[model samples]
Structures are given as structure tokens and as C-alpha cells.
Target: MFVWHGRLYVVRQVLNSWSERVPWWRSTVQPDPPVGAVPERGDHRVWRVEASPGRALGTATYDLACVPPPPLAGHLRPTWTLIRVAD
Candidate 1:
């Protein structure tokens, strides 16, 4: 399950998934994280899935991403990102 815009969506089928490594050197936003840092400020796993809000009949294609997040208060809070949506 994933939440977007405060709506919870359940993945019905995973259409595709892959890993991506961002060339941090080519980034214009900000510098990459320190050495050994996870996610590298760009690397992430993406999944294209068929999903819907709360088991609704209407479904949409959703591009989701997962990354190894940085530590927070000495703990890790792994989160997901809803990259795209197409009904």
C-alpha cells in the first residue's frame, strides 16, 4: 500500500520495476551525499504498477520509487514516492 495526496492506494499488479543510478555529477539541484551514503541522492528503485484507491474499481498506472533513506534520530525511515499517475 502507498499513500498519495492523503489517499491510500493498493498495488494491484506490478507492470515493471528497475533500478536507476543518477550521475550526481550531472545534477544541478544539489551535491551528492557523503561517501558510503545510501541512495546517493539519485539512485533509486522504480516500479510501475496498477493501483487504485481503497479497492475502487477505477485503476491507474502508478510509477513508484523506493530508496534507502538516511538515518533519522539514529533510525531509518524508508519511504515511497509516487512518481507518475495515468488513469
Candidate 2:
């Protein structure tokens, strides 16, 4: 979920979610993805939104497992912010 302008929106679920292999040559990680920590390709979610004025619509991935309370609230509801995730 995220906020735009002054309105709020929620991502009920990812629709056309997909992922690409992390380019090992381009990657800076000391260790590459162990086996298959992430998916190679597939469409993710097509967020369901309640439209906002100045808000810029886009997609972001999140790992709810690490973030704590307050920050997590944004995901559970709508806000004018983006949830950053590393894949």
C-alpha cells in the first residue's frame, strides 16, 4: 500500500509479478543468490488503487519480514510513501 497526492491506495495483491536474474557480473554482493533465493521471471502484482492527484504510480518490492512496526504500517494501509525492498 502507498499514498499519493493526499489520497491513499492499497495493493491487494501482485498481479503480473516477475523477476530477473541478478546479473552476477553486475552484482556487488560477496555471495551470489544461494541456489534460488529469488525468482527468475514472472509477472507480479497489478496494485488496486484509489487514485490520487500528485502521486506517481509505480511498483516496489518489500520484505515485510525485516521491517518493524511503524514502517510496516504503510504496507498495511495507504500512504504517500514507497516501501523499499531489495531483491
Candidate 3:
């Protein structure tokens, strides 16, 4: 569930989804570790979902991402973000 432009939108279906590896070596984003933790597996998982704002004509597609915590870091939780919306 989410709100876009003051209208509430509920995710009705997930059309597609995938994961993208985070190139930490090529970017300034540093992986959190205790100095000897194994390298992270990859980056966030992306999801393409179809949502509706209570109307059939108001249906739209949106992209969401969920970033998992680093390896061995059980104290942290995955973070979700709304990446984009298709018109």
C-alpha cells in the first residue's frame, strides 16, 4: 500500500521482478562490515507492480526496490523504496 499524489494506491499484481548487483568497487557506496565480513551478494531487488487508486482507469505500473542488509548483519532490516511510476 502507498500513496501517490495524494491518492492511495494498492498493489494489485506484480508483473515482473529482478535483482541487480551492486557494483561497490565502481561506486562510492561502501558495504557495511566488521572489517572482515564477506562481500555482499548483490544489490537491491526490483519489482514491477500494477496498482490501482480505487478506479479501473487509474491503474498504473510502478517500480519498487528492496535492499537487503549486508552479510552477517542480522540486526539490520531490508529497506524499501519507490523507484518509479509509469504513466
Candidate 4:
């Protein structure tokens, strides 16, 4: 489920998903690893999902992303972010 612009939407189907690696070389802040901990490799995952607002509202495709936890925090859950809404 996701909310946008004061309206709530439910994910109907996931069309696709893919992982993206963060370009560490391009970043100013280098990732620091905790003692005995392996660094996290991926940055974010993009998901193409079909969502429906409601019976009154039609369905639409949306691009969403899941941001992975920090390198030192392997047990933490990933956070979801909206990327774009397709017409």
C-alpha cells in the first residue's frame, strides 16, 4: 500500500524489479565498515508496480525504490521510496 497526494493506493501487481549498485567512487562520503562486518554492496532496488487508487479511481503504473540499510546495519529493514508515476 502507498499514499500519494492525499489518496491511498494499493499495489495490484509488480511488473518488474531490479537492483542498482551505488557508485561509491562518485560519492564524497566513503562507506565505513564496522569491525568484523562486511560492507553492503547494493544501493537501491527499483520496482515497477501497478497500483489502484480505488473503485472510483483507475489504475496506474508507478516506479518505486527500496533503499537498503547502511553498511553497518545489516539487520535493519529497507525503506520504500516513490520514484515516479506513469501516465
Highest-TM-score candidate? 1
User: Cα RMSD to native, each candidate?
Assistant: 4.6, 11.6, 5.2, 5.3
Superior by lDDT: candidate 2 or candidate 4 = 4
Question: What is candidate 3's lDDT per residue for 1-87, written digit by digit as tens?
Answer: 777779788999999999877776744566465665444556789999999888666778999888887766898777677889897
lDDT at 9, model 1: 82
Q: Model 3: residues >4 Å from true position, as ranges? A: 4-7, 23-26, 29-42
Top-down lDDT ranking: 4, 3, 1, 2
lDDT of 2 by residue, 45-69 (tens): 2222232233476544432211122
Off by over 4 Å in 2: 3-8, 29-87
**Comparison by lDDT, 2 against 3, better one:** 3
lDDT against the true structure, per candidate, is 0.77, 0.36, 0.79, 0.81
Q: Tell me the lDDT of candidate 1.
A: 0.77
> What TM-score would every model get versus the actual structure?
0.69, 0.22, 0.64, 0.68
The ten-residue window of minimal lDDT in model 2 covers 39-48
Over 50-82, each residue of candidate 4 has an lDDT whose tens digit, in order, gives: 999896778899989888777667687777778
Which sections of candidate 4 miss by over 4 Å? 22-42
Give one clash count per candidate, in the order shown: 0, 15, 0, 0
TM-score, prediction 4: 0.68
Pitting candidate 1 against candidate 2, the one with the higher lDDT is 1
